[model samples]
Target: MPPPSPPPPSLSPDLHRVLSLLPRLASPRHLLQAHAYLLPRGGHRHARVASALLLASLRLPLRDHAAALVRRVHPSVSLRAAARLRGRGGGGLAAQLHSLLVRAGHAADPHASASLVQAYCSCGSVASARRVFDETAASADVVSWNVMIDGYVKSGDLARAREMFDVMPGRNVVSWTMVIGAYAQMKQPEEAIEVFRRMQVEGIEPDGVALLSVLSACGDLGVVDLGEWVHRFVLRRGLCQEIPLMNAIIDMYVKCGSVKKALEVFEGMEQKSIVTWTTMIAGFALHGLGSEAVELFRRMEKENVSPNDITFLAVLSVCSHVGLTDLGRWYFKTMVSQYKIKPRVEHYGCMIDLLGRAGCLMEARGLVQDMPFKANAAIWGALLAAARTHGDTELGEQALLHLIELEPHNSGNYILLSNIYAEQERWDAVRELRISMRDRGLRNVPGASSIDVDGMVHEFTSRDGSHPSLHKIREVLCAINSNIKSVGHIALLPESLHDVEEG
Candidate 1:
């Protein structure tokens, strides 16, 4: 057969340069102008320009224009465009592009097939990704298998992800990391640690990513000893060059309730990211070291590490807990006005709780009323607690109404209302509220206390006598009450108690 004629060159040098600039262009207006310049020439095969136009359209906020431009591109150019669409949250458009690739007869190409799978995964079309995996005639490569496994993991199908991992003919560090990371993300620390152990038993050395996953799992499970072992392993492997691993170690220690060890990890790091700073701040905050957290925040700013919402959350929570009302208010305003981060619901809730706990009942109530979004149960709960503390029965009742509307089935709201009435000596109101709670089938949550003894959690509910040490616990409680009464601590009995006794 005669050699196939060389395909016509689609793009000129000048036009290709202009097209290359399209992706870097700042505004949609500039892209549209570029589009206008290229739209009229039919014979001029500017394939590169066409691809750029497709991408620019997709990047624009207006979806319709991007879709139209995508349709106008030739199938080959569109396939390249589809590869670029991966990991951008473009759901429907990614599917359309995959269909276009199959129609163009490029689905058989391994690279093209893998790209399609990745795009499908990126768009959260797990079924479509699986279909592409099944239909491709080319032998599945490691990349294709990884894509499928990663898709399952990303979609939270850990069982399917594990199944895929087990069935794969070949496995690499990436594959092991995916499965291990899945377990860690799902809070199955034991499973994650077991997978790590298996990986080592198979003679596959753990990399920074794999080690970090195991450490995170250990932290979540409060397996401090295991976390310490992982820290030692990282050191022995000499993988300290990876900054993220250092950050992960710091995070694990902090989360495992070891602030001192977390600080040691932070100080030992040769370099740090914003995440490292945030982790340290969180540790201090969790330990109620508000001044230390604030100082760390200042140091982070001086080091030019910009604080994100999580950082703000840690600092603000510290302020709330320590009653640094003015500092909390300042940081909240600074985050919005200077950092340009819009306050989310959690931020608003923190502010409300801060004000409420500080006895600024009126201000907290007003803040909830003026919130940009509707107040949720947390906001109303803060307001109700504040009102009760300040002896504002009317305001407490109003807050309860809003709380009921928000969560009608929550018995705690009714309990709070009853408690407020009881505090005000409104026996009739309290009785009515209790009756209402009974009618609604709402029962108060039983009071429970938990203590950690030798790494094991022991819980005791109100009036619980099931523990083996029940007699000893009762004796201790009686002795404590006797000591308090001997110290002239008189328990106040309600006047209603006498009336009820007579009745």
Candidate 2:
């Protein structure tokens, strides 16, 4: 027989178009077929084709395939390809791409280098990001500088962030925003406000992002007048139409303890996101308007806004505080079955607290036992408290044992167990527990108290007299005690009380 004719070496136009469109295709199966057709034919050498294939692979639910495809692409093309995936909320893949790029030597491109810095920062590797910044060539641009500054800011290295800010040859809104945001995240509201003032003095116009950061700081510090000032600033700057800025304004008002202003901002917004709804719901719940919070949740659903985990947490907190057990149960069930959200540990903790607080100890225990995951300390603590409150000595002991096993080094567990025994008048058990604690070198943690006055928080431990107003505080306490004694309230010893009365 004659030799078989060789197949065509080039892809047909239709096939080439299909291959080019593979990246845009959402279906993994179709993309996989395209990859199979192209990879063996040396298509991996074509930068555009390889990048498209890498992107498609990255989008797949499988990580191994994504890594293999990335490995096949050239380093520079790979870095460029990875930059396109930013802000898509893909976890860890961006960092993996950057690592591969760095290993393959694409760290020369200033833009790519900056992206690597950002990827490392986003992945919680601030040290690695700093190393990359230090080693990269001096051809760094504005984006590179911003990335490094933001990385330091995001990683809570405010001092280094400030150093970078001071040395930056060119200042932009982003730079100012990063510094202000760093101060805000550090809870240094006064410093954040000072940064905003400095930005203004430097003739830098505040953008929506900068305004949001400053507003957040003002809210955190309870600077209601400053919050209102920023609100007017937004309106004057014609930024009220911006959805994110408006949402931030609402959040600021709520956090500043001005619910009326928060509602006004909410009503004035032309558009609202899920965050807006969640923030308002949380604010309502915090202000003790549980029914209003639920009603707002219902309104959010009516507006076709999807409830995220934060929304559920807000509504659950409202249910917990308001003693709406049935509503809470319904919402919890709806969240899992209808919304398809697997309850996280925080959600489970809230539910346990709710049930326990309502004297449904058995139900709470059953819920804990039936949890999909192992119970955490908060869950166990709630259970133990419920047991003590309901006088279930057996359950209390069991919970205490589990807590001790989970956290052997925690002195609080021993103290809690000892208190439980003492509450039940089991003196011998308490004595034995105390002796065991002594053997283990555990001691009770000192009691502490905090008071906020004029936006300044002062903390004191037992018998602390370090405050400048210590004498005034002592005098007030003495006056209160004298008045209480005058009303015939007498202190009684536990033994005397027990002898005089019985439960």
Candidate 3:
């Protein structure tokens, strides 16, 4: 049987009556009223009365009343009572209360000390938090260890968090989740998956939060097979009701280049939040399915799911990819007037790009000029690229000059400018630009392309011979070259990306 509840705290008769009246007192207002009546009546010195005040005062955010209330309690009572201050956490109050505990000589009350650790962690003072942790390390409870580890993770010092995690004598689900999440936050998805595998090895069953982080890692790596396994695990264990988990599932499929699978998951969901619709719409936008993404947005509106700023961004991006200039223009207008959404720089960039691609370069230039805020590099860069594409050297030169001032060190801007001049047979200008490039110590960074085939990603760089199959690759290339030559195809080799020195 459970031990009998501790008999009612001992108290004098008048104080007992005051305590009885306090149960009718609930909030900070009632607390203050009760304290005034009792403290002036000599009940301030009574331990039981102070205990009553402490319980009620816990609701108040200010420390003056609560601190005064706890003062009259016994030290042991104060240790336990001050811990309630944790509800008012994430400020100096907890620290002040911690100081009070230290001043009261109950700094070693393990339970109270553990709660204090939480206060310091919440307030972003991990060092003070760790000091309390070290003092209680001899018999540190699991809660304290978890708090310290989480504190380190929150501070973005994952190395120290991992070190703390490794030294824990035992582990709980929270401990494992913190470590996995730290790796994910740092974008070290590989290490995240490794620790998750280790968490499984240690017999800690995973929770939904743990699974979400792992799925996120899989998405970043484009590991569809791993993501599918997680999906299976979630269904088998019945975690599907959670909308965030389902949202992550949809995101993973999209990132893995399987938009059809993402749709299936979307159609199967029983409950969809704004995130669900936005995520699905974004998946379509990324895959260049512009019409489908727009249709989904319409459906979302019909279903009464309000779109936020992110939703507009996704829709605008879709319009850019599919050359739906009219649709993009309409959406841009609707976003401001109908939705009351302020157009961000990204939205303006998308509009300018759409207009530029549709042979409305002047309109694109006008939009950039009319934008409320100063156009950024992306806006000008969009205009510059369109100018180059259309052979408008005059406009291209103007944009390029602006770009160089903004991104003085970007080699692409210089290279593109040189290319524009060379295409116009402006040989002298091209040579001068090349000289300037060399003087500035700028070179185009090598570009590498990768393709994912049969669950493996292979990256290739121009003139790179580091692949394990390099020899075989060259043999195949030689065979293709011979076939092309037999068919009378000709190839041209340029001397340099800019000016060529005659050999």
When superposed on Cα atoms, how far off is each prediction in RMSD?
7.8, 9.5, 7.8
In terms of TM-score, the best-performing candidate is: 3
lDDT of each: 0.78, 0.76, 0.78
- For model 2, residues 316-380, the per-residue Cα lDDT tens digits are 88898888999999999999898888889889888998898788988998999988889988888
Off-target runs (Cα >4 Å) in candidate 1 are 1-79, 85-105, 136-138, 186-191, 298-309, 329-345, 370-377, 388-393, 400-503
Ranking by lDDT: 1, 3, 2
Q: Model 1, range 454-475, lDDT digits (tens) per residue?
A: 5454566654557776666556
Reference-based lDDT, residue 466, model 3: 70
lDDT of 1: 0.78
Candidate 1 worst ten-residue window by lDDT? 494-503
Please provide, for model 3 over 122-160, each residue's C-alpha lDDT reduced to its tens digit, 9 standing for 90 to 100. Answer: 667788789889988998988889988987898888989
What TM-score would you give candidate 3 relative to the actual structure? 0.72
